[model samples]
Target: MAGLKIFGSDPENQPKPRQRFADDVVGRFRAGHTIDDRPASLDEWRITTGDPDVAARVYELFGGEEPQEGAAKGEDNIEVFTAADSVAIIIESAKSLRQRMVLWGRSGKPIYVSDGEFILDENGHPTEERDPDADLTFQERKEKKDIGAVPDIDLFFRLADDPDLGIFLFKTGSWGLAYELARDDVQGALEQAEGPVKAVLALEPVSFKAKSGPRKGQTVSYTKSSLTLKGAA
Candidate 1:
């Protein structure tokens, strides 16, 4: 008898861009096309497709001379926003007190979280579901029968320089430090800020195991040491 099998049990296979390109090249080769005399290498192809820096790095790895400083704005040139940079702190909601720190790039688009599994819509914009408790006031939540002790506030931060680097969550101790640094401003914003606020964030890199989610045992880094409020919107 044929072995039993579960349909769709295996994860969906998605090919990377390079893999697809390689496959295309193989197909051409099988069709009696010669690639040995091609002018462009795989790295050159990558450079033409918006990854010149990666190509440069690969060249250097193969004993090529290092490119001059500031010659290219690849991975090395990404600027990590420090406490010196003013960040736009958008209070996304009053009920959830959902806060987001935004940094605008020179290109006029928000730079953050280019990779990682964030809930996004078909148009490639971040999307969040409407919270069921969004309509409830804080006091109402405190009085609800099913509600337990308020869940610990979890804050996630994305690096401004490289969006594809993924996001980091604040540690519990770091959360305490941030509270101490901007307690009044945070409380005030939650209570009365009408829109986005401004703040200067002081962050220290930290690594810890995730407390929840499928990634519980995995280590993750976060910038969550402290924050200072600049002003309200």
Candidate 2:
């Protein structure tokens, strides 16, 4: 693994970063085309191909670095390329895609379920298995000991330029647009990856017909991040 220095030790013992949402995020763009190089059906606003103003704003925010350019051209750069949906940067270091559960209440507030302590395998790697000491907060709150738990995936990230930003969580799991994260390609990258996976992340707009919902027959549009992983770090 001499050339595979992409991973590091645990991040918990290190410092945390901020989450890029709303104004904090530079911007998300729909894939101009599919991975095969075909034209995409992108709407107007979500398009981040290259508007002069948008480029200017990006340059201003990033100083020397720009979107047209990939990212820091340093040794730490992993040069990753994901054949999955599409994507960007995240702050991490030898961490698991640690999953938790969530239970919704009548008030519609989300209650994050305890993942308990992750049970590591013989190799010292994390497993979905948990300790029997699971927190009972969800049971107490729902007033039901047998409440069902919805699985959740929490991904934390921060921009290189914005180090002061507190670690933000990108929560998702087997749901609509969020489901893309679970794809084999993207999930594989997360599984193989180790440290702060920073790269040029882009969000491509996607439009499709709803399958089994009230709007089953209606057309809906949403955005998906373009995930890429090149060679090893």
Candidate 3:
């Protein structure tokens, strides 16, 4: 008797592995790839995912656009800022807590910064002494009032014309003693504002020891600071 031949046993008939939409996009982003000197676009995204429909959908989801040919790169296209330079930003939206507010900065970039913590040391200096490794719960932190708290500010910024390249974290004391003083001044201006405001932020690159997570011992650059408010919205 002839050996039985199995139907649908051919390797060529096997279905190809399904591609993930998010993973393809995220991988490119992590590799620091760009389209037209900005973040990658749908066309470029398609090269990796090989799914035109999904790539288009992802592009639309991010509100990204293809860079025009020969289009001049605007000053606002910058990814980095210096202390001497000021960024005029609009506050599109904000989520505020006692100590911090995650803001949608100019161009929709997310800005994570402290309002100023409530906890202070014996010398009356704000400190984050709580060990993240410690087996402490949120309720315990609340009970101890160890929750990070910062001063309230009324300041906001005008929306940027373009989308943000990425997120930024502006710590109160990330720059230095002088930058901290400037940040305080900006906070004071916000406290006095009666309505939505536009502010020019003075940013500087600073490095500090990581206080939490696996990166605890590593040093990283701090890229945000509040310089001054330009005007009201």
Candidate 4:
């Protein structure tokens, strides 16, 4: 019931298309009831979905429109996003992002991402297939003709006060270690969140300062706040 559970959309056309990559990030958004950045205020977690095939589901959730610039009226072009409009729409809307487990993928043409639905049990119940190491398992997704595993899901956002930074990303550190403890906390927190929640955040570099090898002295990103919501007290 915890550790980064993302719900995908299926009812109809919705939220993608601009071609975003892991390194494209500039900043992040946090879940806060107000425009504050301190840690105690931040609550909800902005992490990626646990589904490996989350890539395909992403396109399904937020589909872009086909170009209609040169076409005749009512040409029915696939309503696409020339930019990161869906993220903008969600932020501007009064809807709770919790409605669908959001996992950001790309901004351009939707490509092939593996179907990560859970394999069923003998009695047709979902098996224990969804559990993948939060810091190790990678999605079987890729951009068109692009090599390597899919980049982790990230969000497009900018500080409400620092508009100078433009739109950046609150990248769900899919393979990073520092977020291990936080991911589960996030999974549990999101489950309890409700209503139209929104907020601004200040990213802080945090360290657990592991006393041993490998990760000793390593630094990972940490968002310092969460938005306002019922029961998030």
Measured by lDDT, the strongest candidate is: 2
Tens-digit per-residue lDDT, 42-68, candidate 2: 222122212334444434543432334
TM for candidate 2 is 0.38
Return the clash pairs for model 1, or none. Answer: none
Per residue, candidate 3 scores C-alpha lDDT tens digits across 99-190 of: 33223355654333332323334444456743332354433433443332222233222223322322222323122333344446544555
TM agreement with the true structure for every prediction:
0.25, 0.38, 0.28, 0.27
Using lDDT as the measure, name the better of candidate 2 and candidate 4: 2
lDDT to native, each model: 0.35, 0.44, 0.36, 0.32
Q: Where is model 2 more than 4 Å wrong at Cα?
A: 1-59, 62-87, 94-98, 107-151, 160-174, 185-188, 210-213, 225-233
Higher-TM-score candidate of 1 and 2:
2
Scanning candidate 3 in windows of ten residues, the lowest lDDT window is 23-32
- Candidate 4 residues lying further than 4 Å off, grouped into runs, are 1-151, 156-169, 174-194, 207-210, 214-233
Clashes of each: 0, 24, 13, 25
- Write the residue-wise lDDT of candidate 4 on 71-115 in tens digits: 213322112222222232112222222111112337543232222
TM-score computed on alpha carbons, candidate 4: 0.27
Residue range 1-233, candidate 1, lDDT tens digits: 99555554655643333422211111000001115655321211111112344334333322333423322244333111112212223222233233322223568554432111243344546656433444555456345524312223334333233223233333232224534534455655645766444444343455799988889889985443345555553
**How high is the lDDT of residue 31 in model 3?**
14
